[model samples]
Target: MALPNRLRRLLLGSDPRLARMLGYWAATCLLYFIGAALLILQVRAGAADHDSAVLLIGIGATGVAVFAVLVRASIVMGIAPSTLAAWQALFAIACNIGAYVVTGPLRGVYLIFLLVVLVFCTFSLRPRHTMLLCAYTLGILGATMVWLVATYPATYPAYVEGVHFASAACALISVTLLTGEMSKLRLRLKQQKEDLLAAMATIRKLATVDELTSLANRRHMNEVLVAQERRIDPAGQPTCLALIDLDFFKSVNDRYGHAAGDAVLRAFSAAARSELRAQDVLARWGGEEFLLLLPATTMTQAILVVERMAERVAAAPVAEISGGMRITFSAGLAQRHDREPFADTINRADKALYNAKSTGRNRISLG
Candidate 1:
């Protein structure tokens, strides 16, 4: 069943809170078994009567077994960790109260168990919930104190019982305040960490990406080129670099406006992107100029790819740029040589691009 599988996983999983809960359960069971044994020993030695011993041992054992079963069921049912902790704290308080009543002659020792449970709750429950549990605990202990004084007026005087209650209440309130502050500090630190991570991500994006066109900037493209060049081998597939310049880009800016020029650049980028493969890198090299890096591509293949892109750019009019204007670009592509620097290859491509511009525009020149 799903329940069994979940229970097994919770028990075997590496979640710190769940592991701590299991340890808490085991410690409580061990304490119950120890208490039960002590009560049996006391009965045998005649230090305690049979009825009292049976009452204490029977209630403790039954409570421990029931709580163990509930813990497993809670895990199987996928109860929230905080809810499970609250339930455990409540169960511990109930057992403490029950033990106090059953072992009335040994009530002093039982109150220690109540204090221990309060301490455990401080760490496990939220501040508000822990405060509420403390109030409930104080109320029950106050009632038990009243009952004890009534049952044995000679032993537990009113003044002595008042002092004991006051001391325990002070201890509970101190722990609650301290733990509450710690929890708040922890939450603040976690939020700060997340905010810092978000800021770092924004900074990284700005450093590597162009703000206008959402493409890799010149610096990032240079890094990519260097990395690709290092990967070159004599037997491996070749890499090609292409430099693209928008023909008469300044005329569009002068005739229409800078906004129209910006629009045309964006339109050209979008059109060219569609013609390129996913692995191809496109970067805005400078004003009105772009760089394209084609990995595992030959000179012929890179030229064909650029030719198709140029055809597309010419056929399509950039919408809303000077009331829909057709534009073109000139490109020069060069393949990387064995052990050659990327700067040399880029220089050759730039020279070829100058030749393309001098001869005419709207064409690609291979170097």
Candidate 2:
């Protein structure tokens, strides 16, 4: 039968592991139902005992109903997936024990079901919990064998029961060791996948971000410029590019050492970032030179933005540059020409910046 929508969603939520567990349980239950029906047909034909066939069918139906209730309760109560899996394992063990009691320990094939349950638990349960379940299963099987021998001594002799017990114990131990190894391998692979993702993130950051100033690096800036160029249109608002150069930056480094120069660069980058709009792209073009891309802006607005940035940098002296040494920058603004190549646009800005430096420092010039 199909599950209700709400219950189906609860069992098959965002976690794939939970969905797989529920799917496996449903399939196993269906198989058990089919097996019990076959047993009933055999009983009708006098190939199997009628009482055992009836008992098996009853147990299978009850087990299915109980499992459905447990699944619903776990989802409704927001039980942890691992905890739910543990509960399911315990229920499976109980069902196996019940089946063994009905069919007699020596004749029952329920130990095969127990092995399958153990294998399923290995996927969701921890190694210790799986091991504990294995121990519990072995204990239950051993106790069932002793009880059968004590009650039906003629049918289950001590020597015969001992051989069966030894064989079952060996099989359980082998499966436990195998599943434990498989679990360890799965965990290791999961860890490796996580590590690989972390490394990829680090590499991407290093490729696009400047180490010294934490601004977008030149390569990334060029890519951004190209993307903006493709988006430009004569009918839309104009795009502007600004080339900024730190005035007398070499002197700062030569006078105060490279460390102080680095401090100044970082301070300037931070100040410019704080003053600019979120849409503006600020990148370190090279030593002491930064590029700013302002989309949907005119040349006049770009100039005003650069002038404000210059004021901010001059007002806030770099702390590391002893004696509160002040810093200034010269910028050149250029409006992107209709369908013009991005490189040509950048060249125009660069020329204007040179003009600003040659004419005077700490001012904005239009290209």
Q: Which 10-residue window in model 1 sums to the lowest lDDT?
A: 99-108
Per-residue CA lDDT of model 2 for 180-248, tens digit only, reads 889888889999999999999999999999999999999999888878767746677888999999998
**Over 4 Å off, model 2:** 1-11, 14-18, 30-78, 104-107, 154-160, 232-235
Best by lDDT: 2
Q: TM-score each candidate.
A: 0.73, 0.85
Question: Compared with the true structure, what per-residue lDDT tens digits does model 1 show for residues 1-367?
Answer: 9999798786645565666677788887876676666556656776556896687677667777776666666656788767877877787777667655555345456567666676666556777887898889899889988987898777767777787788778887777777777766766787999999999999999988888777789999988987876674667788899999999999989987888888888878878888999889999999989999998899989989899999887776765564546789999899988767889999999998998999998788888
RMSD after Cα superposition, model 2:
3.8
* CA lDDT, candidate 1, residue 161: 78
TM-score of model 2 relative to the true fold? 0.85
Angstrom error of the Cα, residue 62, model 1: value is 10
Off by over 4 Å in 1: 1-80, 95-126, 143-161, 232-235, 311-319
Cα lDDT, all candidates: 0.79, 0.81
